[model samples]
Target: MVYPKTGSLIVRDGREMTYTHIQANQTPSRSVCFFFPGASYSFDRPYLYYSTMLFLSKQIDLVHVNAAYGKDIPDFETSSFAKRSAWISEDVKTVVFQVLDQQEYEHVFFLGKSLGTVPIACSLLKEPRFSRSSAILLTPLLREELVVADLLALEQNVFLVSGTADPHYHQPTLERIITSKPNIHRYLPQNAKHSLDIGLQVDLSLQVLQSIMDELGCFLDKSLDI
Candidate 1:
């Protein structure tokens, strides 16, 4: 099912940057979650918005970020991952901060899938004012200098979610990552593959949603109070 998406306008330096959002109508939520897709344009379900809404429900507000919205799609592949990462950090993250900063949202959760994970993590770590934030990662990208380790230190409230069946995430290494991270909560679905397709099983979509809800219940509960 498609989410009830609404666009919020952000005007800064005479340039407009608007992020698309789909709010939960059931409960008034203080926390707003920014859900990022994987490598390609994941405007479709099972990745960015649908999974969030299906799993998160009215627990918190959902913001589906389109990393490729205004960019030149042709040059994306040729551009070095580092440069692309920089674009995300400088251009994309800046827009995110500006949009959220312009208005007041209770608590903020920066959630990402695959390639989209590090940018948000790095963005939050670099910015001091973004203390009121949390991050939930699915099929986390391993061994990026920017986002590797030290995630719990970035914010007081940080949550990391992943799948064991996911090819990208190292299940054994995940244990090590979790050991050091007391704040981060990791959930691994049995036989899950990647984001959206966490595992080779029946009703993978539902399991993915439930997994997210399990780790992020704290924020979801806060939404109830909001």
Candidate 2:
């Protein structure tokens, strides 16, 4: 299952950022999506892999950001939360801006999971240029005050998913977000873990995945007015 892609690189903040640009087949696409993977989650992960196919099927170009910290950037692991957030935000912005500068898009979107949600919540959501863009936050760090605060302030459409059993799923924070922002659509799977998988319940996990993809399809269609 090899999809056509163009590998590219960019230097940001003294670091070389590598990414893969996957264009949709057939007609040119007016929409583009940037994907930010979690610290340990790569683009080929189930959620992301299927989502990538979904976007391309809809004729939306995809940019997968390959970002990793810790070993490569030793100080990142020791940095304060604020500093870490800033670092992630900058890296994401550089890739997004560089891509956008070369072409124009009628619609821009972002899909991030876990650690990837940090940049979308803290920076991209607040940027004036992306005011009309939509975002999909998969298993966001709801326990983080900054992330939740920004989510509450979100004005554009966003799809957020998490599991109650996941450590990062904060009921109080999610409640506040729901109470504050009507633009954010949320999905919570009971007993599902961080990967949205039911422990030892392979069938149930697959069911959850189906539901997520279905909901995401509807969200994308609605957002694009398809």
Candidate 3:
């Protein structure tokens, strides 16, 4: 289950950005998952760590996109939120193209958390080549109506995981949106927060996380027909 991590430095918009690539150990890899972490979260964070392991277990390659605001790239701490998001989107697109150029993956899955979903959604809209790629969105920010609209317009398969108590999004409104779009598979665990932690009790939180991962596994199996 140990996957080798390969690091690469790519320049985008005249700035150096670092990205990590992990190849699955399974022979003849069938798919690749592009991970976009939240604004403040890194690949090492619990949610991403566990999710990445799940995908790796399914024999999927991973490309973890690291943005400028994270500790790995702290030079853009003072940049405006809008500018930072734009830069991250470009960086994500750069890495995506690099991976596509190197391999002919049968299926590409975009995994995004919080603000990370913005870039993935935007990239899919701008690039027709990636239109058929599936997406797994974690705690998408409903505040960005444009992002939500873009996600809705995608004809490709999509799986969304959110918490009922996530402060960043109104549960009622989100539920309504998802209700109208029956094709988008969604999981909203009761009382779970943005991080998908349901309670302070260690056991309870672990249970909630396990349940979410189980749902994600099932969804992936059916979507990719693994």
Leading candidate by TM-score? 2
Clashing pairs in 2: none
Name the best candidate (by lDDT).
2
Q: Report how far residue 81 has shifted in candidate 1, in Å.
A: 3.4
Off by over 4 Å in 2: 1-3, 10-13
Judged by lDDT against the true structure, how good is candidate 2? 0.88
lDDT of 2 by residue, 174-203 (tens): 888778888999999898899889999999
Candidate 3 lDDT, tens digit per residue, 178-204? 777776788887888888887686787
TM-score of each: 0.73, 0.95, 0.87
- lDDT (tens digit, per residue) of candidate 1 on 1-226: 3245555444323344456766675544565777777776375755554557543565566777665523545455577766666656665676577557655677777777777776777665567766656666767766554456545445455556666666666655566667776656667666666754544455766866766665566545543354
Error of 1 at 51 (Å): 4.7
lDDT of each: 0.61, 0.88, 0.77
